[model samples]
Target: MSTSRLFSVLDKALPDEKIIQDFSDRIWNDKELNGTYVELNNEWKFIPDNAPLDIVTKALFKEYFEIPFGTYKVMVAIGGNYKSGTWIFDSKILFCNALS
Candidate 1:
């Protein structure tokens, strides 16, 4: 078969808490008829900063946050819907954070 690619950009508002994140994953999937599926691969790199702290505690669940005044680079690979091994993927994204 053949392959296709797609790309998009999104703006997400953070909770105001000191935190940053790299996100990825499938946007939609139709499993019953095996019709459609999307995949996202995300990566993040942060500049050295003292604002961010890594805290580890004894708990079943943990929360993560980014430092208030830090900058970050987020990269993502989006896979578009397709059938079989041929992949129809999106262009990709390199997002830079502008500290608010």
Candidate 2:
């Protein structure tokens, strides 16, 4: 396996935590999280905004937006997707929030 593959492996196996998750789904043994980003129905249009809010809710929303101040991302990885203890997305870009 390549380095990227190894990282992917561990990310799925040992995703320490998943925060601020509202909507989520799993497909064919794949675990997914959603509703963290405020955006349209499309995978795109997820813009970032750091503003003032209550301490708690804003912190919760921050989990989804981990990149720059104003951008969009999808598939903010938390963990899960291993095959028999083989971790995937372990060290590559599991925490990467896609830009849109």
Listed per candidate, the RMSD to the true structure in angstroms reads 19.7, 15.1
Question: lDDT at 86 for candidate 1?
Answer: 56
Report the poorest 10 consecutive residues by lDDT, candidate 2.
Answer: 51-60
**TM-score for each predicted model, relative to the true structure:** 0.16, 0.18
List ranges where model 2 is wrong by over 4 Å: 18-100
RMSD of 2: 15.1
Residue-level lDDT for 55 in candidate 1: 19
TM-score attained by model 1? 0.16
Give the Å error, residue 45, model 1: 26
Cα lDDT of model 1 by residue, 1-100, tens digit: 2222111111223222223332211212333433332222563432222222221111111227655543433322222112334563322222222322
Candidate 2 TM-score to native: 0.18
The parts of candidate 1 lying over 4 Å away from their true place are 1-21, 25-71, 80-100
Model 2 global lDDT (CA atoms, 0 to 1):
0.31
| Backbone collisions counted per model | 6, 14
Best by TM-score: 2
Error of 2 at 100 (Å): 36
